[model samples]
Target: MTQQSLSKFEEHLQDILQYRVEKELLIIKNYPRIIADYDRDLIIELMESLLNNVYCFAEKTITITITLQEKLLIIYVKDDGPGFSKKELLTATEPYYFQNKNSHFGLGLTIVEALTQKHVGNLKIVNSIDGGAIVSAVFAIKVENLH
Candidate 1:
């Protein structure tokens, strides 16, 4: 893994965000030039999944934060929308488990969760205290590889 600029990730996410016409989505990136051994493809997949989920349900805006801890890369995708029910939150990442059986095919979070695990990472879905859904992905990183 090589160190790379996260601007590329932001660009990719913006492209995905632009697809939603109804919601006034806002992506706030509070990040430095995050240099680390990160999997670009997996990260893109994560962002795409989060963006799509938000666009489908979000009412006003979506805020994203990407930050790095000592040896962890954390990405937070938050939306000001009605959050998941307790039952939905529990099985959200499970493959083919959709809250509304008549609505979606239910593969987005499953793929995101799979890719995250493949990269030795974990995904958390919770409702923010401020009122919204927050999907956080924490990836293990090797800081020594940063340039």
Candidate 2:
């Protein structure tokens, strides 16, 4: 893990967006200007996995929000798709659990959970009462690292 600026992370997200054009989905990101100590590659992989999973079900827009509260860095990825079913909300992060048996291998959330935990973080999967699905990753960070 290394200290990384969110700007650099956003740049990586833009690069990931280039290869995905199956849907006309608009990705909106809200990130504060802060640095956190995290594995850059693993965070990127986590974001990619979140985005890829949402892409398969998102209607038009996806939002990525990053915020810092105290010593925790919180990353949330939300989609304008059908919210997860109850069963999915419970088992989505389980290995080899698939909501749709056709296209997905069912490892995306599982991977995200693992990556989050690896960084001393916890993952939350929930359905927005308004609509869509929201995945939140919260990581412990050094308070001094905030800039």
Candidate 3:
């Protein structure tokens, strides 16, 4: 590759990182509003799992944080992998549906689904093609709202 091409690639990488940071901020900012009627620990655990697993994917640069406002508990996990197709995101809740062939019985997402439902919100898997997985769960403010 020529020097010019390499420079362009690096510039592109920087732009992508900047974009992910901005997106993460937006999601986290809305946390308090979303969790206005749910549980906190459930949200925390899900966020932790999401980040740990996404970071396991070499292409992903993930961040997990909780910012409470008003009466919501917002947990967002954003990564920098090829993201997921519409189908993969929607089907993540399905039993035994693994995206990559060898993911330990395909229960990662299933657990995500269970926990998400426990929080009374959705567990979403969004595709970040400039490579990542963005998962966020919004729960209400009450501890009793979770299992």
TM-score against native, each model: 0.86, 0.86, 0.59
lDDT of 2 by residue, 1-147 (tens): 777786787788889887876655455555457776767788888888888788877887777787777777788888889989999999999999887757668888898899899988999999998899999998887543445
Model 3 TM-score on a 0 to 1 scale = 0.59
lDDT of 1 by residue, 50-105 (tens): 67766776778778787877777788878888888899789999888877857797
**For candidate 3, lDDT tens digit of each residue in 1-147?**
111211232233344445444233222232211212333346445654554456555352455545544444455667665677778777876778777776655666677768877867666667655566777665554422221
Residue 130 displacement in candidate 1 (angstroms): 2.9
Instruction: Find the number of clashing residue pairs for candidate 1.
Output: 0
Clashes of each: 0, 0, 19
Best lDDT goes to which candidate? 2
TM-score, candidate number 1:
0.86
Could you list the CA RMSD of all candidates, in the order they appear?
2.1, 2.2, 13.9
Ranking by TM-score: 1, 2, 3
Greater lDDT among 2 and 3 belongs to 2
Model 2 lDDT, full chain set:
0.81
